[model samples]
Target: MILIADSGSSKTDWRGIDKDGNVSQFRGVGFNPYYQTPEEMATELNDEFLLKLKEEVVAIYYYGAGCSTPENKKGVATALGNLFGNAKIKIEHDLLAAARATCGHEEGIACILGTGSNSCDYNGDKITDSRPSPGFILGDEGGGTSIGKKFLQDFIHDEMPAVLKEEAADRFQLTAQVIQDNVYRKPFPGRYMASFCRFITEHTSNPYCYLLYYNAFQDFFKKHVTRYSNYDQKKVSFVGSVAFYNSDILRKAAADMQIHVHLILESPIAGLTLYHKDNL
Candidate 1:
């Protein structure tokens, strides 16, 4: 049996394959060394179904956020090691997962736009170049957090249409105090901000909302995608809810910048499952 995990800042999608090629799926809270301790990760993974399959597990492949550095990767490995004591474990950055899932064995530009964002040039098997994604606070231009941040700013400053502002306030019951507390004092503020994206998506027909998404995606391409040499010659693909859900705006943004989009996926877990199953 083998276990493959695709994790982001908000949740993890786990797929297990048995000897007969049968598959089972499970979900767990997300883990990031930057935010959660090894013990906390273990507790999150202590699900009854996961424990039942532990002894049968021969190997574990974990791709996650904040696993770029060796130290951070090892942190997640340690947590997995404690849980699946006899299983061989491999840990890698989530960008690699996006690359493998989107481009497969083909070279291309792969991007992640979820609660946070990142981009890399994949040379079929490994990442050869990348633009730094300073997370939600400083970057993540095309991600959910960034979009939500823009919406909040417009709403709070009364720059948005009066009707839309009233609707948002009524729908979310948002206030300056509530927004500040969640963004400043809460854990995983990126995820909290991203929660507002649903409202933006719901109101995308509004001109203000439409331009907001377009500008954010345009900024993403300008700042990140265009940084790679020969980027125009390679296929570009995206993986994450932001990319999948807002594909119309994303494609428009790409088109405005003369970029060709190859694919967009809501999550990489499905493609990752196929990749691992074929390799096995």
Candidate 2:
């Protein structure tokens, strides 16, 4: 059996492929080497369904957020190794996952736009270049969290369209204090902020809501994609909820920038499953 995982900031998606080529899936909390220790990850995995298949898992391919640096990569490897003792483990950055999933051995630009955002220049097998991902605070320009943050800012300052503002307040019971508490005083604040995208998505017909996504995606192109060498020439693909749910706006933004979008996936797991299945 082979185990594959694509982990983001919000969740981890698991796919198990058996000798017969049958596939099974499971979901669990997201893991990041930056936030949790190897021991913690091992312990948590033991509680998940993966523990039962540990012995049978001959190879484990884990692509995860926060596994960028060698140290961080080692941390994830250590955690998986402890559980899947008999398996060959390979740990890599989530950017590579997006690349392998979307580009499928073809050279292109890969982007992630979930709770946080990141992008890379991929030459098919490996990432050739990438911009620094400053997480959701200073960066993540076109991600769900960034868009939500902008919406919330406008909401707090009475800058949003009045109808949408009233509906948002009534729907979320949001107060300035409540917003601050979630963003400043809680864990996974970015996830909390990103949740507001649902409301934004529901109101896409409203020009204000549409522009929010449009402008954010525009910012993403200007800040990240435009920096890649000959970016307009490359086929760009996206993996993540923000890109998936807001694809129309994403494409509109891309078209304005003259970028050719190749694919948009809500999660990379499906593409990853196909990529690893060939090797397995």
* Winner by TM-score: 1
lDDT of 1: 0.90
Query: Mind giving the per-residue lDDT tens digits that candidate 2 earns over 1-280?
Result: 9999999877999999999899999999888777789998888787558977987999988999988999999999988888888999988899999998899888999999988899999998889999988888889999988999999999889998999988988999998999999999987788889999999999999999999999999999888899999998999999998899989999999999899999999998998898878876
Candidate 1, 1-280: lDDT as tens digits: 9999999988899999988889999988778787788888888889888899989999999999989999888889989988899999999999999999999999999999988889999999899998887788888899988998888877778899999988988888888777888889988888888888888887889988888889989999999899998989989999988888889999999998989999999989999999999988
> In model 1, what is the error at residue 84, expressed in angstroms?
1.4
Which residue pairs collide, candidate 2?
none
Task: Score residue 210 of candidate 2 by CA lDDT.
Answer: 97
Using Cα atoms with residue i matched to residue i, what is each candidate's TM-score against the true structure? 0.97, 0.94
User: How accurate locally, in lDDT, is each candidate?
Assistant: 0.90, 0.91
Model 2: residues with Cα > 4 Å off, grouped in runs: none
Cα lDDT for residue 244, model 2? 95
Q: Relative to the unseen true structure, what is the Cα RMSD of model 1? A: 1.2
